[model samples]
Target: MSGRTSAASPAWFAAVRPVLAFSYLSLSHLATARDSHALAALAVGMIVLLLLAEPLWHRRPWAIALAAIAGIALWQLKDSAHIHIALLLMPVIFLLLLAWLFGRTLMPGHVPVISKIVRALEGGDSEAMMAELDRYTRGLTTIWTVVFIAMALINLALALIASPGGLLARAGIDSAWSISDSQWSWFANWLNYGLVGAVFAIEFAYRKRRFPGRYKNVADFFRRMAALGPAFWRDLFK
Candidate 1:
């Protein structure tokens, strides 16, 4: 028998599989929080089973459904507090999970996928790219999703309450009375920087290098310390 896979193999597996797994996690978190096995081993086992079964069916609808169900169950089990404390850890887990199951099968590596998307955004119409970017980020985690939703609601409420003319009228009396266009723009930009910085720092520190997984060296240690210098200064001042 030929070892070659069809063109559809990758799209059906790499792209679709992770999404299905995440869907499973969401359902699990919301609906099966009571089960002890919902979070860790059980979730991993479910993913394994889905992976095994997926190839058998040539990545059919049932394969996707099974994977998604498993992912949702596991996500449902994430501890609320741990979720906040370990927000940076969540994407690594998702990336590794995707790589383990579908890395070889996928056409482009993660970095290349991102690079291409960025190029497309800079050169072409941005609407479609923005939509895909939204989907890519949405696959992040339960905590991130909740936080973003809360931010959106807060911003919407702010917009509704402070009519521009009314805000100008009260600006002389109260700091809170002013919600200018510049203020809204500044808030949006600040949020963007914070989120991007957090993700970038995590990726920079932990991603695998060209070499196989190896211990850090003295040089690497010093380099990390150098990177932290700015943060140390800011903290000392505060």
Candidate 2:
């Protein structure tokens, strides 16, 4: 597979995903008071599309049905605080699930997640390269597992302290630790994603420094990774 062109993602999707993501996240903050049904519906639709993108792209029947159900539910319950709470839980659940996925692969008999990806990407062509990456990949997988768990815990904590109606405030505990709803949204919806991106960016930089000569340049590395195709990603998660 050529790094530059093989099975690459669409340029339009690359641009639009971020825009839709931020648009919905920003609207979540705006809808914090649970007063803007229209705004909430738009955000919910964007989120549904984002979540269903992979299955929709693959034209899966069950995913389509689930998306439809989610769409109807969001439309009906857009004004409810329950919708907001559910949205808040999405990040937490997603992170913890990912943490479990990565952590499980590190068990005694199972292949570590990063090791498996590296092996698939390398196409079983080089023993020496695989040997070099084995330990590093395992350690990197551990780091990712830890990062995901830590982020999920932090997200949960913030949700608990989110004021006006969060667990702490609802219990009549007006402590200094309480955070505003808007602040919680900023961290949960925005900064959490940003931090994940930052981690990837920093790791990319360090990988280039540590594994010099493995990739031609930054673009080359990204192209090679992207060439892995959507199917590889879907199956890896499964």
Candidate 3:
């Protein structure tokens, strides 16, 4: 390997990224809300959903898959909740997990991308390092870039086909019934979660681990937050 870090990286980016993304998504949707009541209801529902899903994640394969499918379906339904935040950002989480699980296996043998970027950012690009970065990127382009492009196309197709407006409408909410503001808010949130969930599942399964480090503080925080109860708690009583 080009270089090995004796210690895991700080949780700087991981801690902040999700919050910012979630805020952007929520605010963007709220701006489209026709009534304040709807926005408030959406905020409440979204918080509840986030609390519910956070603990269920646990870096599991099935949870990841369900998250993706649900998030995508919700997006299709035009839901505006933060549930999609988890799903949409699933790719990053998967990368982090992969890096933690198999960091040694996924990183480049020499002059890794991080080092090069840091060096460039700090204005310290030696000729040898540049050549190494070039070599590494060239190899990466040859081996994986095309595959990623193909995967992107596949994801797009899946998203379109699985859209809530398309396949999920078959679930058959009564079209004649006037949807209340709260109901609309709830629907928007569900759609967001479904789309995000789908992305997470897909990325977790397909993407290579490039992020480096063990579980960070924020990940642990969210993991615990998500784990509010047993997965079948709601079903067991029935």
Per-candidate local distance difference test: 0.41, 0.77, 0.40
Predict model 1's lDDT versus the native.
Answer: 0.41
Q: How many residue pairs clash in model 3? A: 28
Candidate closest to the true structure, highest TM-score: 2
- lDDT of each residue in 112-152, candidate 1, tens digit only: 23333333333443677556544543333333334444555
Full ranking by lDDT: 2, 1, 3
Comparison by TM-score, 2 against 3, better one: 2
lDDT of 3 by residue, 1-238 (tens): 1223223324352344456447544643463344333343343334334533442333445556765665555555344443333332333343343334322323556443333333333244568755655665444433333343444343333322332321122244434324333333333434435654675455433422432232244455346434533332222212
Ranking by TM-score: 2, 3, 1
For this target, which candidate reaches the highest lDDT against the unseen true structure? Answer: 2
Off by over 4 Å in 1: 2-19, 27-32, 38-42, 49-92, 95-113, 120-238
lDDT of 2 by residue, 1-238 (tens): 3454334456465455667777878777677655365676777788788777755655678889999898888878866656666656767887998899999999988889888887876765577768878888899999999999999999988888888746566567876788887788778877998999999888878877876777787688778877987567657855
> Model 2, residue 217: displacement in angstroms?
3.6
